[model samples]
Structures are given as structure tokens and as C-alpha cells.
Target: GGILDVLDCTFEGNSTNLGRAIYNEQGATVNVLDCSFDSHHSSNNKKGAAIRNHGNMTIKNSTFSGNQGARSGGAIYSEGGAMAIELSSFSGNQALFGGAIYATVSPSTMTIEATTFVGNTAAQHGGAITQLFSNLEVSGSTFKRNIAQAEYGGAIGVFDSELVVSDNVFVANKDKTGA
Candidate 1:
């Protein structure tokens, strides 16, 4: 029922089991601009290291680096609503799934544009991003030197979802499963 805005801030070295940097719950809207999430680490099998969004969220011109999610979504985990991440960068993030981002649940939409993902790693799958049970559109992005260990999709992984990808660049991304 309310709108929250975070602008031009740096969130660094935050530690938590969930949403080490930011948490946006249902019925809320969040807009993040020109922010940076760095070294936000989860000590356990947590949901998100940087952000956990269950509602509407928009992040632009931001950066995420050295974040660690023990479970999934090292940079962002979005569900249950509309999400947009644009003109951003993610680097050196680690997770079991979606080292950079994980978007799930039904009726949710995510748009990513002009972003960059580099040197991210996932233990199971999706070294850069994992989209499940939702709609995703990514354009003009870059994925470089990312790795997925023991599974597939070193750059982007989508399962049972709608995906539209155009004009993106993927370089030196690999999965340990040889897939």
C-alpha cells in the first residue's frame, strides 16, 4: 500500500539469513536507483543476499558485487509481483542457484536491460540468473566468465517460464556438467 524509494546509496558487508541488504514485502512498492550492494553475505541457506522482493520492485543504474547467498539469489530474489532491473552490473556473486538473480512464482514479470554479469558462480545451477514460473525479458545484456558447478546454465536458466532474450552477449560462461 505504499511506495519506498532508495537512491544513491551503498549497502556493503551486510550479513543475514535473508535479504541482507533490502527486503520488500507484499503490498509494497520499491524503487532503487543508483545504488550499490556489495559483499552482502548470508551465513546460512538463505533466500537472498542483497534483496528479497515479494512485491513490485524497480532497480536501475545499480551495482552488485561479492554478494553470497547460501541457497539462492546472491544479488536478488524476486517473487509474487513485477520486477525490473536495468542498467546494472553484477560481479563475483555466489549462490546455490541464481548467483546473480532468481525470479520465481506465478504471474510475475521481470525485465532486464543493458546489464552485465561477470564472474558469478552457482554451486548447482544458474550462475548468473534463474527464472522459474514467471515471465522474463532480457535485452542488450552481457554475461562473461560466469560458472555453474555440478549443473547447467552458466549464464541464464529458465524453467517452466516465459522468456524473451534478444541482442545479449554471452562469453566464456560455463557449466561443470558439460551442458
Candidate 2:
């Protein structure tokens, strides 16, 4: 509803719709600082199994592990506007599409800094992050051991989108088409 800040919160083993741990709507400004989301699930919808954003979101020093999405964004999903993630980790998450993170619907801003994405999987595209009509800026991150079962982008995908990637490491990512 207004500017929000979450610090040192943990979300694990939850099952629900939208975001398993969080869902933001109506252009709220939110910050998740030093939070953890692990083993969450989305029982319904194609949104975040761990977190969802519909406004300005900033995530720093977080972790997401072993989450599941019924359709999309096993770890995180962002729509509407700008989302900034720094020093985060996304590991062992799964989804039908965009196993780790998904940004879609419109031209949103995504900034990832000093993050890690490891051992995530997607049935279709973007084992780490999927961007549809969005802009992404990633720096000082690592993507390792992620897999894409079909389609492209073991670490990320930009569909009708722009990307600014710098100082990021992509290692041990697997795809059927070899990334």
C-alpha cells in the first residue's frame, strides 16, 4: 500500500497463489532486505513461487531455494515497474517456465547485482531468469548449474527486451540447445 521494508524475514514451505512468500500489487514500493525464501510453492497461477512484484521492489541479501511454480517464476516474478535485486541467491527452484525468476507483462526495469543462481531448472526457457518485454541490468553475479529442458537461455532470456550484462559469470549452465 505504501513504501514497505522487510528485513531478515524467512519464507519456507508455503503453498499458495501469486507469490508463495509475497505478492505486491498496486505499485507499492517494497524492500526485502536480508530475507530468505526456501522450498515454497505456488499451488495455483503462473506467478512467483517465492516472491511476486507489481510495483517498485528492491531485494537485497536474500536467498531462494527449492521452490516450485505451477507455471512460472519458481523463485521470483516481477511485473508493472522496476525491480532491483542485489546479493541474492536462487537455487534449486523449478517451474514450467522461468524456473528461477520471471519478468513479464510490460517494460519493467530489473537490476541484479552480486547475485547467484545455481541448480535451477525450467521446462521451457530461462533457467535462471526470463524477461519478456522487460529491460535487465545484471552485474557481478554468478549463474551455475542451471538447466533449460527446452528452448533457450539457461541463465536468462530477453524476449523483445534489452539487456545490459557486465561482470557476470555463467558456468555449468545446461540447455538442450547448449545455451
Candidate 3:
């Protein structure tokens, strides 16, 4: 119904069943800028330690670190709708899948630019990002020292998704297969 804007905020050590710090339900639009989410946690089997977006969302100039999701998306998750993130940093986050971001929306788009993901860990796939059944565009990003303990894609994983990647760098990312 309306747009919510959050700026220059800090969310630290928050814990919840889902979306420990921020949750945007359907039909809501949110914009976050110059914020930090640190040491947030979601309960067991939950998703999104810092942000869970089922609506339209945009985040810029943000930082997420030491966040944990028991299931997926240690920092951010998008089940539907569109999301855009720019100039963000994700570090030391952990989850079962998608240590940094999980996007699983059909007929929706997610765009990320000029971001950095480092030292994130996932028990399964995508130590940094996972995109499933969605449209994803990533550019001018860097991923380093991320680890996927089980499956493929230590830096990123895509399944039944459309992905466009450009001007990105991946270094020292490790998985069961290799770095």
C-alpha cells in the first residue's frame, strides 16, 4: 500500500523466527540505504537472518556480517517480487544454502551491482548467492574466500534461473569440489 524507507540505521544482534531484522510482506515496498545488519540470526529452519522480502525491495550502501539463517539466506532472502541491491557488503554469514542471498522467484528480477561477498559459508550450495527460478543480474561484484561445505557453487549457484553476470571477480572460493 505504501513505501517504507530506512536510512542510516544499524541492526545488530537481533534474533527472530524469520527475518531477524527486517521482513517485508507482499504488497509492501521497502528501500534501505546506508544501513548495517550485524550478528543477526534466524531460528532453526528459518530463512533470512537480516532481511526477508516477499515484496519489492531495494538496498544500497549496506553492510551485512556475521548473520546466520538456519535454512537459507544468511543475510537476505527474496521469495517473490523484485529486488535491487547495490554497493553492499556481505561477510562471515552462514546458512544451509545461499550464505549471502537467496532468491527464488519466478517472473521476478533481482539485480546486484558493485557488491562484495567474502568469508561466507553454506552447508550446501552457493556460499555467496543462490538464484532459483528467477531472473538475476550481477555486475561489478567481488566474491572471495567463501565456502560451500557440500555442493557446487562456492561463490554462486543457479538452478532453473536466468542469470546475467558481468564484470565480477571470484577468488579463493572453496567447495567440496574445489576452489
Tell me, by TM-score, which candidate is best.
Answer: 3
Query: lDDT per residue, candidate 1, 47-114, as tens digits?
Result: 78999989999999999999998887988888878999899999999999998999999988999999
Instruction: Score residue 112 of candidate 2 by CA lDDT.
Output: 95
In what order do the candidates fall by lDDT, top score first? Answer: 3, 1, 2
TM-score (C-alpha, index-matched) for candidate 2: 0.95
TM-score per candidate: 0.96, 0.95, 0.97
lDDT of each: 0.90, 0.87, 0.93
- Which of 1 and 2 is the better model by TM-score? 1
Q: What 10-residue stretch in candidate 2 is worst by lDDT?
A: 15-24
- Please give me the total number of clashing residue pairs in predicted model 1: 0
What residue runs in model 3 are displaced by over 4 Å at the alpha carbon? none
Each candidate's number of clashing pairs is 0, 0, 0
In candidate 2, position 100 carries an lDDT of 90
- The digit string of per-residue lDDT tens for model 3 on 13-91 reads 9886665788888899999999999999898699899999899999999999999999989999899889999999999
Better of 2 and 3 by TM-score: 3
